[model samples]
Target: HEAKINGLSITEVDFSTLSDDEAMLKVMMIDEPEKLSAAIAQLPASLYEQYNILQSAPFFLEFLHTDSHKGIGVKAIAQQFGINADEVICMGDAGNDKQMLEYAGLGVAMANASDDIKAIANHITASHNDDGVALVIEEFVLNK
Candidate 1:
């Protein structure tokens, strides 16, 4: 694979026998995120037509259909459950979670999050290892 040759890790590729119209690839930057970006620029966009590239973390990336994204997924789930976005509290510390965090009514970034992620979050909790999620649960859910 071109990406693998360019220093990325090709984790998996799924192409449905049902129809080649849908396909997806999961890959990792593997400490070479900067290089991966450069390679992407050189590669032809038509290599995978009508696809979406989501970098969930600095090191993790997924290629999916253009119509799909974490933010869209979150919105759909919230709507299905009859919960308004304003009523939800989303917490994250990764690039992939950025859109979802921003779409939520209350976005909480962890203390260990990247500066870019922290900038847009509504609140910042403790680090993941510090039980930051529990802090959210207690403060917003338990109110104790």
Candidate 2:
């Protein structure tokens, strides 16, 4: 409904029901992503439940629960595994990864990542295809 009202298309959803007990999930992978982005940016502040908008992909817009962000999930997992926030190494190259990168002990942005991500990341690595992950592991793990 939010997508519809915002003139965006909800291409795929894994929701079985809209009950509050179940996590309400929605994604808008529009054919016209530029339009969706523009509309979302200009969305009027409403009294509806606040949502965590993630531009996970250039053409994908995922709307998750207000408190459901990657950083929170990463922190929870790190805690469960008895890891400190600074002991976690997170590498990402997209908007959805912003929080995770910021929260990680070693935040690495891909060479292809956006300026926003690079600005917040602790370090920058090669592009994915160039084996950026391998480079980090080699330098931080094998070399160390």
Candidate 3:
């Protein structure tokens, strides 16, 4: 109903038989954060070994293969293009971004990011709405 009111597009699918190879499970736009957290906590510990279960937001959970992450992708691209890891700069503001932020030579968290994100970041910049990306590029990349 909320989606309808907001003119959003969504498709409901039966996931009971979905294979991990076929899909990366995403439970999105959850209305109840506490219940979702409780349910996640109840999941088997062994399941975590096979998947990277990321709570991207208070209401969003994403499950992907353990071997797949933003960090891995960034590393792969850097290696392929002959760009050193020490030359890479990454920024983010969500739990899903944890890996990439950690992998970067300079990890920048948005000022509006969660506490845990800030804890892992090398620096904290302005919020997304305040041109945070531009600021990082100007100061760190352009160095002027």
Candidate 4:
């Protein structure tokens, strides 16, 4: 309904009919910034136990699997590829990326990232709009 009011297109699904393999949950894009904050605040407490609530952006509230954090994925991939933890560099700016940032050998936070994120980051790069990730790649990966 919020998507309809905001003139956004989304697939409407009957959640009850979905099996575990068919669906995890729904994603909501709140167009209004103020309403986004309110919606996040009003999220039921029970949802936390079963899901990893992530606000990837100011208006996006992403509810993913509780065990599906980026840190775990990164670690698994590193092990699979025989890479050491100290050889991995991870970059992130959102609260949901906290775990991965901590797990990274060098955690990079964008200049526009929150203070908490910056505090945990090993390095602070430019904002995403200014090609922060690309810069990190150039400096770290390409050694340029």
* TM-score of every candidate relative to the true structure: 0.69, 0.76, 0.80, 0.72
Relative to the true structure, candidate 2 reaches a TM of: 0.76
Most TM-score-accurate candidate:
3
Question: What lDDT tens digits, residue by residue, belong to model 2 across residues 7-105?
Answer: 976555445645657645554445467877786777666612677776776776677777777899999999999999988999999888988998999
lDDT of 1 at 19: 71
Worst 10 residues of 1 by lDDT: 22-31
Ranking 1 against 4 by TM-score, winner: 4
Q: Write the per-residue lDDT of candidate 4 for residues 71-140, one digit (tens) a residue.
A: 9999999999999889999999987787799998999999888777899999999999999999999999
lDDT of 1: 0.76
- Show model 4 residue runs off by greater than 4 Å: 1-10, 16-22, 134-144
Over 4 Å off, model 2:
1-23, 45-49
Q: How does model 3 score by TM-score? A: 0.80
Segments of candidate 3 deviating more than 4 angstroms: 1-11, 17-29
lDDT of each: 0.76, 0.80, 0.84, 0.83
- RMSD vs true structure, all candidates: 6.3, 6.4, 3.5, 4.6
Clashes of each: 1, 0, 0, 0
What is the C-alpha lDDT profile of model 1 across 22-138, one tens digit per residue? 443443344467866676677677745756665666656566666565778889999999999998899998777778898999999999988878999999999999999999889
Any residue pairs clashing in model 1, and if so which?
56-96
